[model samples]
Each structure stands twice: as C-alpha cells, then as structure tokens.
Target chain A: MSSCEFESLEKCLESHLPEAELTEVKHILFGKETKKLDLPSCALEAASERDFELKGYRFEAVQEQLRQPRRIRVGLIQHRIVLPTDAPILDQINAMHTRVGEIVEVAAMCGVNVVCFQETWTMPFAFCTREKEPWTEFAESAEEGNTTRFCQELAKKYNMVVVSPILEREELHGTLWNTAVVISNSGNVLGKSRKTHIPRIGDFNESTYYMEGNTGHTVFQTQFGKIAVNICYGRHHPLNWFMYSMNGAEIIFNPSATVGALSEPMWPIEARNAAIANHCFTCAINRVGTEHFKSEFTSGDGKKAHHDFGHFYGSSYVAAPDGSRTPGLSRTRDGLLVVEMDLNLNRQISDKWSFKMTGRYAEYAEELTKAVRHDFKPNIMKE
Target chain B: MSSCEFESLEKCLESHLPEAELTEVKHILFGKETKKLDLPSCALEAASERDFELKGYRFEAVQEQLRQPRRIRVGLIQHRIVLPTDAPILDQINAMHTRVGEIVEVAAMCGVNVVCFQETWTMPFAFCTREKEPWTEFAESAEEGNTTRFCQELAKKYNMVVVSPILEREELHGTLWNTAVVISNSGNVLGKSRKTHIPRIGDFNESTYYMEGNTGHTVFQTQFGKIAVNICYGRHHPLNWFMYSMNGAEIIFNPSATVGALSEPMWPIEARNAAIANHCFTCAINRVGTEHFKSEFTSGDGKKAHHDFGHFYGSSYVAAPDGSRTPGLSRTRDGLLVVEMDLNLNRQISDKWSFKMTGRYAEYAEELTKAVRHDFKPNIMKE
Candidate 1:
C-alpha cells in the first residue's frame, strides 16, 4: 500500500492499496477560478485581419503564400514551477494549474487559437534524481489525468486547442514515459505522441525515467491547422521532423526544458534547421528560471550534483520556412509568446525548394529498406 | 580534326571540329616559376604540441579529447577566377593557376597539411548562361589532365594533400561532370567523388552540366586524416552528411560557388547542423566576387538573365563537432582559412551524446523498411 491517499491516481498505482475520493478542484478554489489578468495591452500581436507588430520582437518580410493564408494565433507558455520537495505532489500540481489558468485567460483575451506548454509542465523535472517513490505520483492516464481535465475546460471556455505536455502514461509493464497530450478546441481528446529520443548524457540521464517513445510521429488536425509535437530530446533527430513533414505538418511545437550549460548555444539552432529543412514553421519553447531540489546528487561521473541545475533560459522563438525568425522572448523572465504566421508559407517554401519534388524518397526508401535488417551494417566502406 | 591544336587536350576534344594544339602552360610563363612565400612568424600555428591563436577567429574552451588530440592543420581556399569573357579559356585558366600556386605556397609555409580549392577552381561558372560552347572547353580528364598535373607538382613539393575540384571529364561523349580529384601528399591520384545532388532552380541550373554521382560516398586516407568531399549541392542533404560519417570521414569539405541571394541565408545554418549531428568537422568553401559573361540569358523563370549573377559571397568557415565554429572568412574578399582541430573530439562527443547507441537502428530500420514501399502512406489526420 502507498503512504499517501489523495485521489484515484493513488489507487491506479496499486491494485491492493486503499483508495480515497477525489476532491473537486473548483470546489477548493471558488473565487480564484474567474480571476482577471492585468498585463500590458500591446504585449500580444494577435492574428487579426490587419498586420500587427509589438515592441520587443516583430516578424519581417511576409511573402505571399501559395494558398489563401490560414492565419492562426499561437501562444507558447514558458513557466517554472516553484514548490518545496516535501510538499504534497497533488497540491504542487494544483498551484501550477492556478498559474496556468491565469495565463490562459490572458491568452484567450489576445485571441490565441492554440497554446502549448513546456515538457512535463504540470510537475517538476525529477528524472535526474533517479528516485521512483516521489516522481511516480505525477504520472496519470491521458484520458483521466487532472491536467487533461484542466486543459479540456480551458479549451472549451476559450475555444482553443491546448497542447498539454505532461509526464504521462503507462510504463511498458514497468516503465514511465515523457508524453504530450493534445486536447482539441471542441474539448475532445485528440491523440498523444511520446518522446521518441531519450538522452543519457551528463545532467540529462532521462533513460532512468522514460524509455524511447512508442508513438510513430503522430500529427493532429484541429480547427486552425495540422500540427505535430516533437518533445524535447527528439529535436536532435532530423528524420523525426521529416516524418512530421511527410505527414503534412504545417507547424511543429518543440516543448523543451533544458538548462543553460547543456545546450544554451544550440537553443537557437536545431529547430530553425528543422524549419528550413522541412519547410514548416517551428515554435521552440523552453522553461525559465533556475530549478532547485532538496538534496544534492551525483551525476554518475563522480561529480557532485549541485542543488541547482542552472537556468532554463526561456528564450522562446518562432522560425518560418523561409528562414525568417521572430525575436525571442525574454531569457530571464516568465513569458507567454504569441506568434502569428500565414500557414500558406509552408506550401510556398516547399514549392520553391523543390525538396519534396526531388527528395528522391524512392532512393532513401531503398537505402533504409536495406538498413532495417537485423544484420545490417551501417558502415559500407568495410563491406 | 579540331579547330584549336594547343596540347594533348585539343586532340582529346576533336573529332570533325577545326582544331589547334594546346599550349604548354609552363612554356607560356617562360621565366615565371614557383615563387616562395614570406609570411609572419606566428602565421603557421602548426599542431606542434602548443595551444595557439590567430586573427579573425579562434576556438573557445578546448575540452580534453578522448584520445590524444590528433590535431591536423587544414586550409580552405576561396578564390575567384578573374578575366574577361572573350579572353581565351586557356589563358584565363593560367591566370587562376598562377594565383593558386602563390596562395598554396603560403598555406604550405603555414604548416597546412591538407588544402581544398573551391568548386571548379580553374574555370568560370558559366551555367547561368545556359549556352555551352566555351564552358565545354574547361573539361579535362581527372587521370592525366593539366589541373591534375599542376596539383601533383604542388603536392609533391609541399608534402601536402590537395583536393582540386574541376569541370571534369567527359566532353568527348557529350557530357560534363562536376568532379573533384583527390591527390595524396605523395602526389599519387587517390580516386574521385562526383557531385550527387543536382540543382534546377534559378541561377543553379547544373543539370545542363552533369549527371548524379555514380561513385558512392568515397573518403580518402592521407597522412593527416581521412577526408571526404561533398561537392556543392550535396550539402543540403543531411543523409549525405550522415553517409560520410558512417563511412568514417573525420573532415568533410563542401566546395561550392553559390551566390548570396539564393543560399546566403542558409550559409550559417546547415553546415553547423551537420557537424553537430554527425559528430565531425565540416569545412565550407565558396568562391568570391561576381563573374560576368558576354551574353545575357534567361533563368526559365520568365526573367531574362543579366550579365552578372549575384555575388558568390566567399564566407568560408569550419565547424567543430561540439558546435564551436571559426569566424567565417570575408564575404567579399578571396581568402584562405586554416583551422586546427583535434580529431578525437568526434569520439568524445559521440560517446557523450550516445546517439548511435540509443538511436534504435532496429526501430528506424523497421519504420524505413515500411516507408520505402511504393504504396506507403504517410500518417495524415483527416478532419
């Protein structure tokens, strides 16, 4: 039996553990549910009929799209969770839900059609600890999780597609996954995709928590556009992005939670490479502020793991297919980046580059066809 | 049998056309032999067991390599051939040859063990004209051509490996190939690799000149390191870079003659991505200055071609496996950029990232095995 008794999640963890009735979150916070947001008026440049601009970051040189422009307003939220280690995981998540509600209300006012959060946004990143007892409390089913329910309410209220990246899912009998769930604007449960690539280097020993994703490059169709989610580490794989493009993704969202030292220099690079190579718009989101844990740990390299894991560097930016980029959001502060792009730019850039016309997929198909055999050798020079 | 009989080349290109014997280039420059170089003392930062620095660009934060730092000094030369369009092709080539000898001597004095010249270093990029009369005269046999012989003498004298990209080889059979001949440090021919990808867009209508490469990814072994050349257009393909990495190429050089408007925006991007993704060093070289032809042509985009194509933008650069890059050479001036790197950085980065270990080749093989089927359908979500 588990030590804590909170909700159905506690029961889901064990067949023999005692269960407790779930509390209604709205019943706990009655007055704060409808709280109004007070923010800068022109902070958001909505995707209305006329062209718009904001102070810090603005787009440049809009080219004509092949088809009529399918304009959509997208909001990428970067937030850092603050909670004590000993605090109940349920209450910690509740605090995050309240903050997200405040941001989503403001995004609705700015007319955002879709919003995405950083990887495993609902809980703190505890994979570095390699401890299972405390972290397992955060995992919930995609269908009945508290986060899925919270996002569904916001989706219906604001008529926006919400891409809620959370630590989800069932283990392959004994493992957990870093997953992202897509909720449609109509409050329907659209599908979910897992993180295909896992990192095992210093500070990012993610294989301790989740294995490779089982989902094969899934994209969702909402009211606004065809979109795909390439979670954190998968951004390193070009073919991962190409699969989404072959499936016809106009916009790709890479929700990541990486620190400064591990990849700050590369933050501006990988996604932009994907946008150029795949001829699609890419939104790269990263969490802000420094994350600290209760105890120091070792990084498996005999070095002591400090309490703080560096700054998240929340410099979220959007890149178009034609290589044009919007100025990044503030690197130090919490930010909600709202970007507007004509979806037709995807088709136009693809037409001009002629990559699909001449990609010679047949050639790659033949090469990969031979590569999949169990005895396949990658180095042909030796053969 | 031929209109011009200047040398052995005239006999090779003549059937029924009026001919003249080709002139021996060494004979034309009667007294002008190979000159020695006079440079500063610190210009040659040889990998002689000491850390060094140079003007224009320097490396940042050198990490300890997994093995001994297998440092090699490499130089990439970006030079433009200058002469009037009506000038004889033979004389124009001789001018380029004289200038190259001077630059190469300087490179050798600087302790550069391996050097690469820009695409078709001895000839004009006349593909923009779409007219084929004079450009065909630049074709030569890779086995015993004049360019090959000139590079052989330089290689033997300097004890350096030379990669000479040229308009080679089959004008007799009504076809021309964009090829690069690799001459060993001992001056022996070390095979060749043809350009794989062909461009058909505006300004880069190279389909008029060559067929796709019949040779697979070929890497040459030299005293300094194993090297491969991905001739200009192949840089756009990530798979091409991956192939070279799989074949064990430590340094891959891309020799190109692209203008500013078409690919300048992409210049800083693709090569860096290849270096990071493949865990290898990449050297990118492009010709400088604008070349003009006597006749105007059409781009097939309904726009008539002007006398000059856009600027070649000679910003040659080198990128390390860890994503550190040397400052690019001058965009408008001819330059020779020499870079020093530890070959063991490749193994260290690969070990740290472990992409090859966890890349799930069996998984990708299964996916690609299915993807290559003629009736394979991409995963698309319908509304």
Candidate 2:
C-alpha cells in the first residue's frame, strides 16, 4: 500500500479503535510482520487458536496491509463512594474493593488497558475538622495494605493498569500521607507519589492528619502517554500543576473528594483553569454521595448544644484540555462516566495556544518564590 | 448612661457591625440620657434652627453614642452590552448609550456610590476579526467623544462616579488607544488610564484595532476608595493585574465584551484566579446577548458562503478576594446585578491573604524582563 493510503487507514482505524479490537489487531499484525508469512495463513491459524470469529470482514487481507504498531485502549475509572463517615474503616475498604472491582470488570470487557481512581478513594474526608481516631485507623502501609492487595488481584485479573489512592502509612516515621499507587496489568507495583501540599483552611485540616507529602511533582511513564496525578488540594496551587506539565505530562488525573457548598464553587473553577493554563487534559474525579459525620453544634439560645453529622455532596467530572466538560456523573447517584477522547487533541490545542512555547517559566519561578516571603513588599511606586 | 448601654447603641449604629436590638433596661438608660440632653436648664441648649425629629431614636443621638463614622454603602455596577457585528458603527454607539443609561438608572435606584462600566463599552468586539472601518471611526478624543458626553450627563443626573471605556483617538500621531475615563459625580472628568496588554489570539485582535496601551499601571483616587480598571484581555497577563493591586487599588474592575463558547469558559476562570492571586476584589462584567454579522466562509465543496454573527453570553459577576462570589450576584445571569459591598472587606481579605505583604516585586521584575527574551528556557531539571 502507498504511504498516503496507509496514513488514511491508520487515521480511520484510530477513529473507532476499541479496547478489544486493539489486542486482536496487535496479534494479527505482529504475527504477520515477525514471521514474514502470508497474512491469510497467520490469521487463520491465530483465529483458530484463540477461538475468534473473523465475522464478515476479510481479517486476513486487512492484516496484510497493516504497518503501524497497534495502539492500546485505555479507560479511566473515576468514581465516588457513598459511606457514612462513622462507618467501620474496614467496611469502607471492602466497599471500595467491590465497586472498583465491578468498574475494572466493565473496563476489561471493553478491552481497556488501564483504569484510574481519584485521590484517597478509600476513606472519608477526615481532614474536614481534625478528628484523631479516623487518622490513626485509616492509615495503612503502602506495600502490604489491604487496598493495595485488592487492587493487585483486580489488575492481574483484568491485565490492566490499576491506579488507586490510599492513606499511606510510613512504618518508620509513624505518619500518614496522601498517595496514589500505580499497579501494572501484571499486578506489580510500578511506583507511587505522595501529595505535596497539605491544605489547612476551612474543612481541610490535612496538616493535622498527616505531614506534608515527601515526593515533589513527578510524571509516570505508563504504556499510554506520560501520566501524572495531582492530589485534591494540590490543584489549588499552580506551581504543582506547572511542575507536571513542564515535565511533559499529557494526561494528568486530579482525583478529588470535594463536596458541594463548601468547596463546590471552587470545584468548577480549579481543574478547568489548570487544564487551560497548562494545556493538558485533566480528569477531576470528585466523590459522589453524602457521608454523614457527627459534629458538635451550638444553638441560638447559647444554652443548647447537640451533635450532628453533615452530608457530603458529590459531583465528579472530567474536563477536556480545550475546556469542555464531559457529561458529569450525577452528584447524587453512584455511576461511571465514560468518554472517548482523542489524545492528539492536546497537541492541537497546544499548537494553537502555544502556552508551553510562549510561557515565561523562569519569570514565573522568580515571582512565585518571592511571593511567599512575608517582608517582600511590592514595587507600587515603580510604574 | 451605663457603659454597657452605650456599647449596645454603638453596635446598632455601625451598619456592618451586625445590627442588634437594645434590651428594655438599656433602652430605659438611653432615654434618661436623652432627657438629660433635652433639659432647658442645661447649658447646652438645642438650636431652634435644627429640624431634628425625635422618634425616640435619632441620627444625632446615635452619632453621639458611637464615636466612629458610619460605614458608607458602596455598590458595584457590572454593566454588559451586546454589540451587533453587522450593525453600522454609529448605530452600535447609539445602542450602547441607551443600554448604559438604563444600567445607570438601575445603579442609582440601588443606592450605589460608584457605577463602574466594563472596558471599551462603546464598540462591538471588532478585535475578533479586524475590519478597518471600525478602527476608522474610533473615538478621536476622550473629552470630546460621544461616549464621554453620554456618561457625563448620566453622572450629573445620578450623582455618581461613572467609569466609561472608549476608543481614544490620538490626533497628533493618528493612533488609537484603549482608554477608560473616570467622571466625577458632578460630570467633571477626573482621570483616564490606557490598557497595558493587547492580546493577539482568538477574538482579541487588539493590536489591529489600536496601538498597545503605553501608560504604566496606576489607580484613580476616588472618594469611595482607590480604584482601577484593567480592560478586557488584560486579565490573562498577571503582571498587569499585579501592578494595579500593588498600587493600593482596593477594588479593581475587569470590564470586558467577552462572550460564551470559544472564550467564555476562560472568562469565569481568569477573573476569579486574578482575584485570588492578587488579593483584591475583582468585578468582571461581560456583555451578554447575540449579534448577527455576515462573514465569508470557504466550504470544502468549493462554494463560498457566509456565517451569521456570534452570540455573547452575558454573565457579569463580582468575586471577593478570597474567591467567594457575593450571595445574590454569583450566578451566570443577565440584567442589572446590584451588589452592596463593604469597602473594608477588601482590607480584611488582603490582610488575610497578604499578597502585597509577601509579594517580591523586584525579583519578579528582573525575571519578567529576562522572560521576554527569545532565548530564555525554563530550568525544569530543578525540582
């Protein structure tokens, strides 16, 4: 086939390439190219071995013309849990496993190579008003934690990348950290990143529950494009987002557990802003469903006092690099939101905006570092 | 009167202090104080010329009890206008004056001390695609322009500080500028500011319509507070907003003709980001409604066609420095949005965020100059 025809075929194939289609295409193309054998003979032998039906299309002929490597189908699984804040921590973990397992199965059936969860998906928002026991019991060792083991089996079963957030416990330091563990399709732990900024305002008393994260901004070299995870509160700080983008992160996941009313106004603003500002597609997954937690309340008479639990409103969503939101998952319902996106759209947007090419990063660093100093006065007098 | 009774009266007089009703005991004591002041035998006799109304409570009595001046009610008028792309230049100008007059009347009824309009309120957004006729009819002089005369009359009738945006024509150089003129309550022109940055992408073809604004960032001192206007498209350049905030501008206005869809998503994000980043209250006024203009379109079938004018989704809003939208005006809406704000709130928010207190302006200046150079590269290697 001519190069122009090959290019057109590749583009057409990419348009509707499903997860399961990828594996079939890969096996047929690889076998034909490596063996230098007839495409029809290789396909018939491979199809028989795999018990696969060729359907109406001439699979053998189509395989003969294929030249480019088969692309993998990756799916993101962003979900929110609906558990009472006072429920047993173990129950929450088990519930997460069941739900995540179901999502993994669904993605696997669709032939997705990877599935990702939001930041700290297994626990209630303990930072929203510091309470002691929740932190003590919620923290778990990264390597041997129950959540990790569950994710491992799921990953191995589906043969997909399983990215999950957990309350990481440092055995030596006796402290907790907000972290994400990337388990390979083979169930091997690839690596993990600890959240950088620990917010300490409003309901976010993260500093009291755990120390600041140790890992700086980083990107993981997945089979897909270079991916990075910026935990919940870190999205508010521009420097953190910039670090990952400047390092060439094409797809960044911001798995968050924010609810409506308190931080909800900021929810629609932050992730989209980061996407546009950094020229990267960002998936901001917010936990759905309310978690009732008992808290002290004072009455109007100044004599009455009671304990109450407030509800957590959930509305998780994914924002494209061009600033359009995929139909957001219901804030009140438990469901999965799936979207088919062109990874190349990032390049198209970047070429148009040229934020990376035109961005003055050196100047930003100087201004940011100086902005943190208490005594550094602004030069208002100088025009 | 007892000190506790005097304190209650003081609290009641301070509007922002949270209004409270005096107890029966405190009322009795205050009545005694009023009686003591009213005694004819007392050396301090009431003037016969004084037309004081004693409805058991009076302004003089409240003033005497509270030593501090009453807080003035400041209102922010966020105005937006829909300019038809196909309409004649003079027709568009006439439409803007009528729309502005209606908004001014609304501001007067709301008891607003100052009504600030958006940047370049006179013309349709010609910057999107530069057509020369629009630039040819640019307002030649700020003082002698039609926009100025309209605004001056509105200011005189309403007794307000009217901020009007116009296309300033520089007669000597035959150049045009994006300028904002501040008119006093008595219709006297106070001062004017030229926009600093002219954006080049999307619909902002500012460079084609007018020369880059030459004046450095500065604020206009008004009776209400130190205020400044940063015209549309300037919000993207952080330094411009920083310069205004650093100049003791308690309140800054970002008046724009930006519509929804193409750049609308960026609208909600940029203004609030600027408010939080700079630690200043920002009022972002966007023109709403649709305009029709015929644009030549080249089709794939080789037929030339025309596209109708675009729609400007108006959602004018005010964002507090802490990034909170005021109660009623936060939503995306059209019409006159009246927000009663405490000027002192700016001080409170700035004190908390300390953007000015901690900002390192000198270091940023050095870095910005370096960044403008073509060869500067980011040092991403350093975490």
Candidate 3:
C-alpha cells in the first residue's frame, strides 16, 4: 500500500499486523497485568486491505468463584475526514460514512460490543476558521441526523452500541451544539450528551459556534455496559469525569479532536487519571491528520494567519480502572483500538481503593456552594 | 561513596553530580517551554560530600513586561528515616532533624524560598503494623511539636517557608490526626492542613491511627508564595487538589509515602493531572527506602504476613500548570527536587486555558449537593 510521506511504515505495519506477528508487549499498572489480544486473521486482513489500522488488548479481573466475569469489547476509532474541507457537505459526509463503515466491519469481526468515533468524525474540524456558513451546514439533528441514522444501522448490523459525536443543530430553534448521540444494539436512539465545556483557546473559538451543553452528565445503560461521553474540552474539568462516575457509569469515553501542538502531552494523562480517580474505564480518542481550511484565519494570538489547525495527533487509547492502559494508536494513522475489559474490575478496584467511601463529596459540596457566594471567605492563612 | 548493591552507580552519580555534569533535560507540556537551572558549586559540592541527591528545573511565563516575573524556587525533600523503626522516639526525631537539616542547607544554597518534606518525615512509616504503643508515642502537638520546632528553626535560618507533615496529637481532645504544619519564614506557625483522605488499601490501615482532617483546604500565604499541602493519600482525590487551587494556592505539595507495588504508576500521573486541572504548580514527594519493622503484619489479604511495606519508590518530581515537569529523583535514593517556577505562570495558564471560566462549579455544586441526599436520583439516562 502507498503511504503518505509523513507516515512511518514501521508504525503502519505494526498496527496492521496481528498480535502474534508482533513482539510481546507487557503492561502493568499499579501491579495489575494487561495482555494483548491477537485479532482474528479476517479482521487483520480487512485492516490491511482497507489500509486502516487495528489493534486489541485485554484487561481481566481476578477469578471469583461466586460470580461470573463480565467481559465486554470496546472499540475506539480515530480517523481523518475522508474529503477536503472545501468539498460539498453531503459528499464529505458520505465519504466519511463509507470509510467508517469499512472500519466498523473490522470491529464486528473482532467482536466489539461497543464502538466510538472521534469528535465530529464526519466533517473537517472547521471550527478553527470561525466562519459559520459552510460549517453550520454540517450541523444536523441529534436524534434523526444522517450520522445517527448511519450509526443506528451499523449498531443493529453488528449488535454493537455506537457513540457518534457530531455537531447538532436543534431542529426548531436552529441552535448548534457539540453532541454525542448514543445508539443501542437494537438500533434505537438511547440519548444524546452534549459537550459540557466550550474552548476559547488558540484557534478553537468553539463558543462562537455553540454554547455550553444543557444536558448534565448522562450515563447510558445499554445492553453491553453503562457508558457516558465527555466530549472534547470537557476532559480538562475533573468534575466532568467525576459526575459521570457518580452517575454509575462503568465506562466514560472522551471523544476529542485536540491538536498535538495544543494538547498531545495531556492526551495520555487526563483520561487515565480519570480512570484511576473515578474507578471506571476511560477511553480517550483524538482525530488524526491536519485539515486545511478554504480561507486563512488568525487565532488572535499574534501569529501569522494560517489555513490549517495544528496536527490532530491520533493517539487513541483505553485506560482501565486499575490504571492499566492499552498502547495507543499511531499518531499519524487512522486506527481502531479494541480493548476487551472485564467489567467486574471496576467494582474490584472500587472495593480495593474505597475512593467512594473516602471521597468527602458533601464537604466539598458545602465548600463549593459557599465559594460561589459573594460573602464567602476562603481558608487562606497569612502570617 | 559506596552505593547499595541494588542501585546503579551511573544513576547514583547523576543525582549526586551537578547539572553542568549531566545531560540536558527539556520538558514541554501543551507547548509551554521548561528550562533546567544549574545549582551553585557550593551546593553541588555539599550534595556530593553529604551524599544526598539534588536537582533543579525552571518554568517561565511569556515575557509580558506588564508585571515583574514572580520567580520562586520550591524544594521537595524525599528521605529515609535515619534511625530504624525500633529506635527511641526522641532519638529517631533528632536523627531525622539532622539529616533533613543538611538537605535544607543545600536547598537554601539553591535559593529555595519554600521547602517541604515527605509524609511524617520524623518517623518511620509504622502504620502497617497497626501498633499503637511506639507509633502513637511519635504523635506530637500540631502547633509546637518537635518536628514543627525544628522546621521553624530551619525556616528562620533560611528565610524559607517550611511544610512539615507529622502525626499530630490534638491537645484538647487527645485525638491523633495526620497533619502538615506550615511554618512562615519568620518562624511563626501559619497554619496546618491535615490529610483529608485516609487510605485502607493494602498495608495502609491509616484509619487505625487517625481520622480524616478537620481543617478545610488551607492555603498558607507566606512571604514567597501561597502554598498548601495535600498529605499523602489525598492526592488520589482530584477535588482535594481543586479545593486548594480554589483557596488560591499557587503551589500545592503532596507529601506522600506510597509503595511501588501499589502505586508506582499513579505516582507520576496524579499530581501532574492536578497541576493541569487546577492551573497551579504541584510538587509530589515520596519517601525512599523500605522500612522494616520489628513485627510482621498481614494486610488481611491472602498473602503471607510481611515485615516491611513494599519499596517506598522515591521518584519525587514537580509539575507545572502547563503540564511540563522536571525529571524525578531516582526510585531507590533519598533526594531533594528543586523547581524554579514563575508564579505568574499560574495566572498566565489559567488565562490561556480558561478552565476556571468554563468550570461550571455551581452546576456541580448543586449536583453534589443532590448526590449526598438520601433520596437523590443521579442523572442516569438509560434506555
């Protein structure tokens, strides 16, 4: 296969190959062991043929004779938009649908019970440009949008839950929101979670397009497991991750589209820290490649006008409640990271750590309530 | 100097030697640049002679020229107790004071405005045995304990703010609390912050010794900077870190004594995540050496009873608000980490990320208030 000059052939081959063909990779987080899973030959071959990347890993819970282990396979897909930003909206959407379809088929072969796509996967990340004409055209209904309909079909076909992050246009009011629409395996729309936090940093003037989400931290209980979505910039807020876990989410997905220049170093840390702090599995996915816009835009930060956002480093990975995490996808490739997790590990870790028992939420609730008041005084000691 | 059979000579020599003798280490977090600082020859020579590890790094804000640079050097000392667990309380305390004094002299030579030691630095970690006789004997008054008095003297001598974590015996009630006393440069006790969260994991039955902290998140405003302490296990809770930042702490110290078998991986990620989330500086210090007690103890797990807690794993490091951090001290050595920070960078990063603006704390405050209620229903959106 012909590769981009920017892509490393060695990394491409490693993700495309079956685990058996690769060298052994052992992972230990706080002493919990993680093992890699070799994908089926059919899935590997499909990935090779389609020129997309696929890898799998497994996390297990200690065997308890009293209860059966609850195992679930989750897939996180990170990809670039198939077409250019200047392409016709429908054409770009359709091309993305087709590309994602091929990858979803491989996930089905790998027996992934749930799958998630990168943030606003069907469109070029045009929020940086701040022009509302063509970009707003990309927004659609959260319930009945074309992307949701497509994901519903894929979910039913594969018997897998699907989380699709898209720019949603409130049908009656014409309001735009960054939303993740969840579809169950039975092909029904479960619910939608909007991005709770909006970014105003660098070229990401996301507030210009959408306001903060009104829907609170929503954990969806599906056929496979309990899950929630913390979209993009919401990962920076620790309480955003905390509320979802408090809502009984077993797996929280952070589907983000952050660039390397802006947030790559943080990519590996935040979600993993969330998993450790909250006693739940966290999946962090970022988009790959750069998207050049039709017109030059200035970030207002004294830099020369540029046409493209910095590289959207795709290092999608999964972190377990025990702090063990799967190796991420290539920074320069479109890849699917499939992780098989024993859901019981969440309870096992919680039982072991007792974070919930020890977390002084009520104390902080009172503190925060007071802090928001005008007459509140912080406990600052000065000698 | 003769080294332990387990430690590498190369690793030992690196920390003992000055920055000029070692390779350069550059840190970048979310695009912020961090530079290493060279220590004075006198301090380097003292480190080599006294044989304790020392290293320094610096973080800077963009040259705004609007305000003078708020440059401050903070030091974190992670050390092993000089005397064994079986040693007399007074003797052990005296020996610890002497060893830490030598380290503080080096820190003073490096121009550290503030310095903190590991959890209960004056005593061997004896909570694992759940013994009260000799261990409770180590507990002293929070306001005028022996450890606090020694720290006050050092603080006055170096004109440095001192944070000393100790087992505090409340005078009125005679209750024991794990606390950190903050001493001002003028040798006055500013205040004390206690370990808000107690661990019950593995060998840490800290509840057997002390209850949760009564002091709210206390930020001590000294002459150099505003600082706070999150003693040991409190680092696992993100809100604990958030509360300190909310109280206007520019730098937070996590004086910890965690073992490798249970928390090596989390050691690096948690404090760094707190810095990124809180838009502040965090110095995480963990004690070196495995302290063997005279008596064996069982963790109630299926494992055999043991005498020592697993390796303390000293890899102490400092993290900046922008996510950059210095190289940590060796895992098997007692060391002091000195980080030169631009306190203005805290405001710079907060302004840049806009985390505080978008945090939506009032929303979570309401959510947490509801969550602590008896009849509260979580926002679980299940089909």
**What TM-score, over all chains together, does every model reach?**
0.83, 0.66, 0.94
CAPRI quality band, candidate 2:
incorrect
In angstroms, give how far residue B129 of model 2 lies from its true place: 4.7
In model 3, residue pairs whose N, Cα or C atoms come closer than 3 Å (at least 3 residues apart or on different chains), thus clashing, are none
- Candidate 1 local lDDT, B1-383, one digit each (tens): 11111112112223212222111111111111212223345444431212122223323323574445677778888877768766998999888888788777767777788999999999888888878788878889887899999999999999999999998876467667899999998898888878877776765678877777767677777888888898887777766776677667889999998874446656666777788777888989988877888898766666766887766867688877665666566655667777766677677778887765566656665666566577777675544
Put down candidate 1 lDDT per residue, A258-331, tens digits, no spaces.
Answer: 86444655666678778878888888988876667787766666776687666676768777777656556555
lDDT tens readout by residue for model 2, B58-157: 1111232324432332344333344555677788788878766765665565556677775667765555545576545856578777888888898889
How far out, in Å, is residue B26 in model 1? 47
Interface RMSD of 1: 24.2
Residue A60 miss distance in model 2 (angstroms): 30
DockQ head-to-head 1 vs 2, winner: 1
The segments of candidate 1 whose C-alpha lies over 4 angstroms from its true place after superposition are: A1-66, A171-174, A300-302, A369-383, B1-66, B171-173, B300-305
Q: Rank the candidates by TM-score, best first.
A: 3, 1, 2
lDDT of 3 by residue, B7-26 (tens): 42224334433342222111
Local lDDT at B19 for model 3:
47
- TM-score quality measure for candidate 3: 0.94
A125-186 per-residue lDDT for model 2 (tens digits): 65654567664687777878888998889888878777788889889978788898877777
